[model samples]
Target: MESGFGTRRRTRLFDDLLALFLAEGFSQFTLDDIAAALHCSKSTLYTLAASKDDLVRRVTVHFFKRATAAVETTLSRNDDPRERVAAYLTAVGAELAVASEVFMADLNAFPPAREVYEANTAAAATRVRQLIEEGVDAGAFRAVNASFAGDLIATMMVRIQQRDVGKATGLSDAEAYTELATLLTNGLRT
Candidate 1:
C-alpha cells in the first residue's frame, strides 16, 4: 500500500492537474504546459501519469466521482420521487452553470472525454427513468412512457443548463428547478 504522504501528494497533483484542465482545454495544453503551470518538471508528470491520455482519464474519473456524490446527496434529501428528480436536475444545472468555459471546450476537444461524457449521460438518463417510473407507480405522475419521456427531459435539461438559459430568463437555480418541475409534473399528471 502507498504511504499516507504519497497518497496526499498524489491527490494534490491530481487536484492541480484537474484545475489546469478546467482552465485550459486539454488539447490546448501540452505536458510542458501542465508542468509549468504546476511548477513541476515534465519528468515529474511522467512519473505521476503514464501519458497525457492517462491524465485525462484520471481527471475524468475524478470529476464523475465528485458529481455522482453530489447527485447522491441531492437524492438523499427527499423521499418523494418527484422531488428527487427536481433536486437532481437542479444540482445538474448548478454544476453546468459553474463549469468553466475551458472545461467545456476541453471536453469537446478530447474524444475519449466525450465518450466518458456520453456514458455518464446514459447513466443519468437511466436514473431519471427510474425516478419517473417511481413517480408513476406512486400516482404522483401520469401514465406515460417513462423511459422515453425521461430521456427527452434529461436531454433538454442538459441543453438548457449548458446554454445557461436560466441567466437569460433571469431565473435562479431554484426558480429554474421549480419551473422545470412544474413542466414535468404537468406533462406527467393524470
Candidate 2:
C-alpha cells in the first residue's frame, strides 16, 4: 500500500524529471547528466528507475498520460464546439511549449517513447474528428470533409511537433498552436 503523501511526492518528482526531459531531451542524457540537471546525485535517481531507459519510458508515459488528461479536461470545460476546438489545440501547444528541438528529435528516435507519442497523436486525431463531426452536426462549422480534415490536422500537428518546422517558420510551438486554433476556428465556422 502506498501512502498518500508518498504518492504526491513521487508525482512531483516525476513532473520535475519530465520538465528536464522536455528542456534537454532523453536519448542523449546519461544518468549523471540527469543528476546534474536535477541538482541531485546519481544514487538519488536510482529510487526512481533502475536504468536511464526505464526512467525515460516511465517519465514519457507519465507525461503523455497527464497531457492527454489535460486535453480531455480542456475539451470538457467549454460547451461551445468552436471553443472546444480552440481549447484542444491550445492545450496541445501549451504542453509542448517547453520542449526543445533536441528533445523532440530524441523522443522520436527512441522507439518506445516514439510509439507512445505516435499512439497518442492518433487518439487525439480521433477526438478531433469527433469534434468536427459534432460541430458540423450543430451547424456551427462548415460542412467540410471531416475525415480528410481530421487527418490533415493530425499531420499538421505532427509536423509542428518536429523541430525543423519551428526553425524554418521562426515560430515557437505555442505561437504555432495559437495560429492553428485561429486557422481552425475561422475555417470551420459557418
Candidate 3:
C-alpha cells in the first residue's frame, strides 16, 4: 500500500530513516520495528521501498549521498589548503559521530551496507589524496607520496570503524577518529 506523499515528505521520511539507521544499525530493525520507531505504518514504508532489504539499501544510499555532499560543502568553506584537509577529515568523523557500537557492528555484518560503506571510504581516500596534493602545493604538507598516504588513511579509517579499536584502546569511534585526525595532520605538517 503506497502512500502518495509529496517528494518533500518522502525525502523527510528518508532522513528520519537514515538517522535511525545511524543510531541503531540495520540488522536488528525489522520493518515493524522501524514503523514503530518512525511512528509510521508498514504500508507507508512500502511507499519508500518494497522490502526490508530494499529499504536498507535505499536508506544506506541516501545516507552516503548526503554525507558526501555535506563533506564537500564543508570542505569548500575553507580556503586554506591545510584547513581544507582538516575539515575533510573532521567531516568524515562527523558522519560517524552518531554511529554507536551496535550500529557499526550491524553495518559491517550486513554485506550490502558494508559494501556501500567501503565505497564511501574509497571515495574519501580519493578526496584525502587531492587534499594532500593541495597542501603540498601550498607548502603546508611535505611532498611525499600523497597517494600512498591517502591509502594509509583509508586503511586506518576502516580499522577505526572496527569494534576492536574501541575495545582495545578504550576510545569510542568518535574518539578514535579524532585521534586519527590528530596523528595524520601532525605527521603531514611541514
Question: Can you list the residue pairs that collide in candidate 1?
Answer: 142-188
Alpha-carbon lDDT, every model: 0.71, 0.82, 0.83
Expressed as tens digits, the lDDT of each residue in 117-186 for candidate 1 is 6676567768878888988898887787887888787775555434365447866443565677667766
| 100 Cα displacement, candidate 1 (Å) | 1.6
Candidate 2 achieves a global lDDT of: 0.82
Cα lDDT tens digits, model 3, 25-107, are: 87878899999999999999999999998898888888889988988998888888767777888887787777767777887
Clashes of 2: 0
How do all models score by TM-score?
0.79, 0.84, 0.88
Q: What ranges in model 1 sit over 4 Å off?
A: 154-182
Compute the lDDT of residue 59 as modeled in candidate 3. Answer: 89
Candidate 1 residue 102 Cα shift, in angstroms, is 2.6
Error of 3 at 172 (Å): 2.9
Per-residue C-alpha lDDT of model 2 across residues 25-54, encoded as one tens digit per residue: 888789998888878788868878888888
